[model samples]
Target: MDNSAQAPLQTAEDPLFIGGVGLKSRLFLGTGKLGREELIPEIVAAAGVQVITVALRRVDLSDKSGNVLSHIPVHVQLLPNTSGARTAEEAVRIARLARACGTGNWIKIEVINDSVNLLPDGYGTAKATEILAKEGFVVLPYINPDLYVARDLVNAGAAAVMPLGAPIGSNRGLRTKEMIRILIEEIDLPIIVDAGLGVPSHACEAMEMGAAACLINTAIATASDPVHMAEAFGLAVAAGRAALLAGPGRSLVAGASASSPETGKLTAFLEANAASG
Candidate 1:
């Protein structure tokens, strides 16, 4: 057996720090669009995801019957999102309600005034982040990846900033790559690339670009084989992170750099071609 083929897994490295919480998995999974609640546990395990996002409005009634919360593994951290909130005030209310569920105080502030595209309102998100952070909630605000908005979020005491790669559930991978890259360059907080990531490769691309994490939902849950897709995403994220740590090579605009040694290079092909000509 080739010893080189048996390299160790990359997840053994230091845990990702977010809002003073150390998380082992950088891939944050959203528990939405999952047809059945029973599948969440297996999906989470398959994805090796430490943080799972859930919407407040989706929770089953408090009658202790068919509650989605019961399905999630207790070990995984819950990050409840303000999906139905359209303003900062509304977002704050929903966040408070989510906290009342006895889930830890991790909140993903998503204040969307635009219903058609479902784009997060940067100002409203910052506002909610401020209110939540002061209230002792670990705030992770979803935004449009604008540098100014990110600055505002940091000032508002955001633990991390979740920037959209594209519109929510569009399955358009990295449409806002440049903006996300700008956030990564400028912001001090962890930049989590969330939403619109179509496939495993998209998550891999975001991770390779130095994103602190990738939050995905529609892509995995809607797949024909959700469990396998989850596993694929987990592996892709790990490989991309490893590649980032390995320090990828520099790019050239219009030139090729030869890999093989120039000395005693294969002249046989050239000579044969010349003879044939």
Candidate 2:
């Protein structure tokens, strides 16, 4: 099978390198909360996503028809996440299991015990990252937008730091924008804005703010039309990335700035005509 068709084409923008792998697409999709599992391939094709995250629990290898792995194309990189893990130990176990299942070495460390908020446990996450990274796993830990925790993850050898835009599955959209901005500026690793992105504009804003990528699942899955929403997100991500590369104009602090030059020939002519009149 020619799976090369499944890979997203590289754009004019530079590739996003993580764990020494160059990814063309900045939009990373998640295979959770989808109305139909069969839509995975279609969503990937629509979004042109190079990386797709899947919960370890969803991989049912025994049943080929139901297996999430079966639906995913070989060209796309699989990022198996430790979703149900509540502690560092459990997260390590899940990651190890994922690798054992031949899902590759890339793992998204998610240690969340809080059922109410569904927020990641930073301490546990860092610890797991440290362990998994040592074991040769490409670790991407999902965390709160905390500078200290990010620093810890860096020291722990994380390939990238994934901070939440808001509470998981809330679709609130970059509620922690300032904090994420801080991480982007401070952290040396790629800052992938994960969770709570409700719309294409939210993804665009994140990219404009210099986020390396955006991981969206719930918004696209629960939307009225998942495929269309995926394509919208894909375009939005590309546009935002291009805008960032283009070097957006600086914002004024108080007064509005005129688009036309203040001291140009046209301006002088207009001023003279007004004065003469």
Q: Show the colliding residue pairs in model 2.
A: none
Model 2 root mean square deviation, Cα atoms:
6.7
The worst-scoring run of ten residues by lDDT in candidate 2 lies at 1-10
Clashing pairs in 1: none
Full-model lDDT, candidate 1: 0.86
Q: Considering every candidate listed, which one attains the maximal TM-score?
A: 2
TM-score of 2: 0.87
Candidate 2 lDDT (Cα, 0 to 1):
0.90
Query: Candidate 1's residue-wise lDDT over 42-119, tens digit each?
Result: 877677777889887654456646767888877778999999999999999999999998989999999998879999
Per-residue lDDT, model 1, residue 148, is 98
User: Who wins the lDDT comparison?
Assistant: 2
Q: lDDT, candidate 1, residue 130?
A: 94
Error of 1 at 198 (Å): 0.5
What TM-score, computed on C-alpha atoms, does each candidate reach? 0.86, 0.87
Please provide, for model 2 over 43-159, each residue's C-alpha lDDT reduced to its tens digit, 9 standing for 90 to 100. Answer: 888888889998877546777567777888778889999999999999999999999988689999999999999999999999999999999999999999999999999999999
